[model samples]
Target: MSLPLPAPVSTYFEISNGSDIAQVTRCFTDDALVVDEGQAYRGHAAIQSWQRDAQKKFAYSVEPVGLSRNGDRLTVTASVVGSFPGSPVQLYHVFDLAGDRIRSLEIG
Candidate 1:
């Protein structure tokens, strides 16, 4: 069964399946921050750059296997298979939403 995700979170995963960088950025707030691999991407410009860099570096796909909430954060546990060092890895995506958009996300 698929977990029920919020609008922006749902959109994030949906767009992530493809290479639509603009759609991915649209799921976040104007001042959103995204952290992945110890690098922080602030705002759409930085986020776009991050996405582009990742796309250029690896060919990968992510499948969200679980979801849970903690306080104001929603955490999605996903299985990611990519061209990186670890072909398959379980990642934690913690999202903080503001209204219909995501305010922040930390992926590990």
Candidate 2:
């Protein structure tokens, strides 16, 4: 599915699917915060580390299937397929954008 997303948001999915751990940090702000699996990662370094760790632990790809907005926040419903316990599952990715970058992202 293709959605008309902001540049930073679109870059996010692209880089994520590419699995380039190094480049993933460029999609966010220097002080961006990410929350996933009940843990919060603050700043680019932490977020990068989080992504690297996750990539090492699981092989997954997410396709954004739906989008919604409330104020400046975006909620993306994505279809995830991976080698994890749940081979396929729908997940929510809530993003907060800052200028042309993502200020924060929470995935559950």
Candidate 3:
């Protein structure tokens, strides 16, 4: 039997593994909003800046462990590893999808 795959997990992997700003930008809407650690970044420009800054500060990888969806919203539990003291961080991502792109993403 074929196992069912999780959409959010697949999308998360695609976006996380993508190093190109243009390719990653394609995963989000034109006016997408991303919130992380109480900071909110709106639009592609801000998103790209945030990604660049993050890459500079932390060398990490995101591994999705669980996923759930409710209508246009998707929630994912991921394991994050970086250069910080507590190198590994467990994060929850809440994604709001509009069609094939993500309209908003909140992380905690």
lDDT of each: 0.86, 0.86, 0.75
> Candidate 3, clashing residue pairs?
none
Clash count (model 2, backbone only):
0
* Model 2 lDDT tens row, 1-108: 788888888888876676566665668998898999999999878877887787788889889999999877999999989989967999899999877889999998
Model 3 over residues 16-102: C-alpha lDDT tens digits?
Answer: 654565565667788999998799999988887877787778778887777787998888888888776687888888889888788
**lDDT, residue 23, candidate 3:** 61
Flag clash pairs in model 2. none
Give per-residue CA lDDT, model 1, range 1-108, as digits (tens). 488898898888776666488886668998899999999999988887888888788988888999999866999998889889978999999999888899999999
lDDT of 1 at 19: 49
For candidate 1, what's the RMSD?
Answer: 1.4
| Candidate order, lDDT descending | 1, 2, 3
**Where does model 1 exceed 4 Å of error?**
none
Q: Which stretches of candidate 2 lie over 4 Å from their true place?
A: none
After superposition, candidate 3 runs with Cα above 4 Å error: 1-12
